[model samples]
Target chain A: MVIKRKVAVVGAGMTLFRRRMLETGKELCFEAASMALESAGISMRDVDAVVLGSAPDAFDGVHMKGEYLLDGAGGVGKPYTRVFVGGGTGVFAPIAGWWHVASGLFDTCLVVCEEKMSSLHPHPQYAFWGIFDHTLERPLGVNLLWIFALEMRRYMHVYGISEEEIAHVAVKNKRNALDHPCAQLAAKITVEDVMRSEPIVWPIKRLDSSPPSDGAAAVVLASEDTARRICKEPVWIDGVGWSIDSAYWTDRELAYPAYLAEAARMAYRMAGIEEPRREIDVAEVYDPFSYKELHHLEGLGLADKGKAAEMTVAGVTARDGDMPVNPSGGLLGVGNPIAAAGMMKVCEVFWQLSGNAGKRQVKKDVRTGLAQAWGDLMQFSSVIIMRS
Target chain B: MKEGVVKKGQDIGVGRGIEPNPVGSKYAGIEVKESDLRDGRYMSIRYSAMFRYRWDTGIAVGRFLEGLRDGRIVGSRCNVCKRILVPPRVFCELDFAQIDDWVYVYDTGRVNTYSISYIDKQARRMSSPVIVAVVELDGASQGMGIMHLLGEVRPEDVYVGMRVKAVWRSREERKGAITDIVYFKPL
Candidate 1:
């Protein structure tokens, strides 16, 4: 809100999203961080600070994970910090990097987000059980899908929607992933395939969800003057916003994500975006589940309430369609490594805006783009708008 | 030959580098099978850590749990906002004022939302599905609900706005926990 130096995304890189990788979490961080530095044409000597984002130490099977990932994140001898807001940390981490540069404290910041869900024994979904109220909800034995399915069902019931319609988001995103080099679940499937897939929950089929993955993503954010000197075309961080709702998630309606809308409003207001549906050329929203892409689209006001599904069914969210969403295949198409998934969205937006997204680039001429993430039992949301 | 002659460029390490995939050829990573990992073929270390929490439920939750043990549903009233919260809290998060009093709410309410879960906390498949629901207590304010189980009905039969009542355990068998009420059954 006050006067400060500007920040620009000069480089971004990501490792392959997979179910299990030979490299450990710290090793994955090094891979992505080094690639990001190479892409920016700057070495670690140019980066003055490091900010890492990852979700659930339980998944990594480690504690004080920020400190653990420091060396691999290229923070061996620099101002280092770790930001965690559940799954929102990926995009939120960059907002932290932006702060370090915007505050004039650091000229260049290397932001890294990684998640090795493979460390979660049995399955990564089990780690989410700890997220519940240890006393109240845990004794009832609830899994993550229960809440997501309940919300999906409620959204369908309230709007008279159907599972068949929601399946189309998965269809679009997975197909879009066919063009993504980092995608883990990229496949060409029909809505019928989605409908026929094994049911995890009544409304959520197996194919409708993103796979738990091991991966890492990194980005280099530099101050305006540094960006001008290092790169010819730097993607400016136009505005950033984040918000959290009451932790009493069950006490609120599941049909809409009010927190995300609040976050979007904060970001749009800061970016001076009066009409998001028109002004923002593209968006890379968090879509761990297929319905979520549609849900966030509505929350971002890119589509009206209960209209996102209709728009998706009409091919309005396709790469070639108007206001394309998840052009990098989203989390559903790409794998979900929690924090890395959100960071990948930021990279996707940066790529889309810079005209560097090869096969997944949108047909529309992109200028201003928005990226958002939601997590922590639907409590926290991080939104960022960028321009080239 | 009495002595062995070594080559100049000796290669001993396994050449299992990153795999080649036409789908995403540019991205780099390594992969292994589950078989190799399960039988100690892959050198690794494993251990377990135990954590037990003695959480203090504090004022509102302590009273709320006490109410559950008494076979009653209770909510706290924020005097300023006058909103009755079912899963009660001490201070009004919005008003930042202490809640005035605890009020008893009906055990019967409509199912605000429900889900049929087939997996347990460990992500293991259950033999039969469990119906979980968010019951909006009758006397509680709109959308103020708690996560609980639903019973005595099929998953397809469960719907939003379906009237339901809590099936509580015997008073003598009750503990001051949420499980005091087994599950909610449709009316």
Candidate 2:
């Protein structure tokens, strides 16, 4: 028990995840922020502060991006701030907002995250090349997929897992996305189709990955008293934790994410959840690739090491499974807009816990749920727990 | 604080969500639609540039580069952890101590993991695929793989734990870069 005020996510809003949209990054933030304020039954005037999140200056093709997106994020004339942790910024933005309200500094906080990956030429993936070690790894002509592919192969080799077994996650998530209104690449794909799909890198295929997207997401947070007054049901962020490993990614075993496990341990301790496999009702994890969902699940302690892929094989992570994950289609199906996609995970938890996710609702009666996002050379993990 | 002139949209109404207005209605009376932008009613344009950087490859990386230029693979060994770090650095990230010594590692190593890349770094499809592997050098440590291209082997034949050795360019061709080593060939 910390002596901080409790914080609740009163409302959330998001634009459809798509390959490209007419809206610029700021415009996207405005639409999502406005919708979120409306959902909370309030206008921007009622908010005391604002927090924003987006990944990379290269993707948006601008510098000083925090202030660039300020007015559209409803941050003008308020205590505005920005938080960035690459892909982890999605969940991390709300976590920042959580502390803003919890610290008694602001009664209401607006959190917005946006990414316009289409603005980058060649492709969004090209912007990722800049993140590697400029002196060492970059000179080798490396790309983002190479690292993910390397990690996936190591994980498979260590645990004796197969690509075919991992393809099941693609099948499950795409089918799950068919029910999501904002999904970009939702389809009835099969493991066979995944096996036959074109490979970008041998282990990572076209269907196995999330599409590059341009989108934005927003949420409104308020103190306990304010939430009770403004919302009929406010989803409580019971716990939050984040951890980042060394930048020397190659030094550690690529098969597992010790960073995420450490973060999950801290969050579970704060929430008083000892048996995560049984206690957590549902989850929405970062899944830019299908193998990533399994990797993150094990990291979250919801499944044992080497068991996440087996659970996917058993259909245990389905919408109706004992502990469902990614009920809103996840990044693989919805779209990978980086920071916005991470924020979308927070939105999914809010929607699921409040019974507001219309067609993509998990069969489980979810009173407690978790959302997580990983970023930066497989080194960072952020977690947020919510209860209805 | 002013940007562009805004025109009224025909779809404005109570509870109709004015967010669809592309030019913004922040001033209460200002709004514009997608059609107005098409008709050149508002002024907005795209801008781009090619930015470059000249980063100083300090201490650790500098030594690593020097070693590569001399046709040798070097690693830093920490006395406290007793682990050798390839692509050598000056200090151990886990322990806050400076490394005790620079150790020479065998160029031969086993592939930890690899990928057959059909696309270039820019996400453009390549005419021919490149084979990239994370090779854990024999003396550096397990899981500490230096990422490099693989050559003289079929893509299907490249597997985890497969033995490989560096295929270097001629000494005259050395450029003090990771490309100094052309590719790793199967031993």
In every candidate, how many clashes are there?
Answer: 0, 1
Go through the candidates in order and give each one's C-alpha lDDT. 0.89, 0.87
Backbone clashes in model 1, listed as residue pairs? none
Residues B1-187, candidate 2, lDDT per residue (tens digit)? 2345545664434332223432432211113334655776554466778779999988877888888899999899888888889878888888888875998899999998888898999999999889988898988966677889999999999999999999988999998898999999999
- List, residue by residue over A213-271, the lDDT tens digit for candidate 2: 88889999999999999999899988899999988877778889999999898888888
Report the CAPRI category for model 1: medium
Where does candidate 2 stray beyond 4 Å?
Answer: A1-3, B1-46
Model 1 misplaced regions, further than 4 Å:
B1-24, B38-41
State candidate 1's TM-score: 0.96
Candidate 2 to native Cα RMSD, angstroms: 4.5
Across A216-335, the per-residue lDDT of candidate 1 in tens digits comes to: 999999999999999887999988889998988888888888888999998888888999998989889989888898888988899999899999999988999988989999999889
The positional error of residue A285 in candidate 2, measured at the CA in angstroms, is: 0.9
